[model samples]
Target: MKITKQNIRTALWVTLSVLLVTLLLQNSANVNLRFLHLRAQMPLFAVIMLSALFGAGILWFARRRR
Candidate 1:
């Protein structure tokens, strides 16, 4: 198989996903989030996943159109 950018990206994503899953499974505690009086209790994994998704969304939107 020829090495390409797509393959590299796929490999990286897969590795990151596996690592994230392992981390999530190990951390299952409730976390408190208080932002300027707005408070919430959420699973550590959920918060991490949501933050990652939010960052990805921002990057996706910020990418220059070609």
Candidate 2:
């Protein structure tokens, strides 16, 4: 099959997804998380994923067209 931009993106996404899954599976220990005034216990993977989601959301909001 001929290579295209969409195919490249798909491959990258799949690779990232696999890597993320592996990381999450390997790290599941609970840790104390402090957010502003609230403190709570959260899984290590959950904390990382939440931070990633927040970062992605911020980037999308900033880059989206008005």
- TM-scores, all candidates, are 0.86, 0.85
Query: How many residue pairs clash in each candidate at the backbone level?
Result: 0, 0
Residues 3-59, candidate 1, lDDT per residue (tens digit)? 999999999999999998998888889999989989999999999888988998888
lDDT for model 2, please. 0.91
Relative to the true structure, candidate 2 reaches a TM of: 0.85
Cα RMSD, each candidate: 1.5, 1.5
lDDT of each: 0.92, 0.91
In model 2, the worst 10-residue window by lDDT is 57-66
TM-score for candidate 1, residues paired by index: 0.86
**lDDT, residue 6, candidate 1:** 100
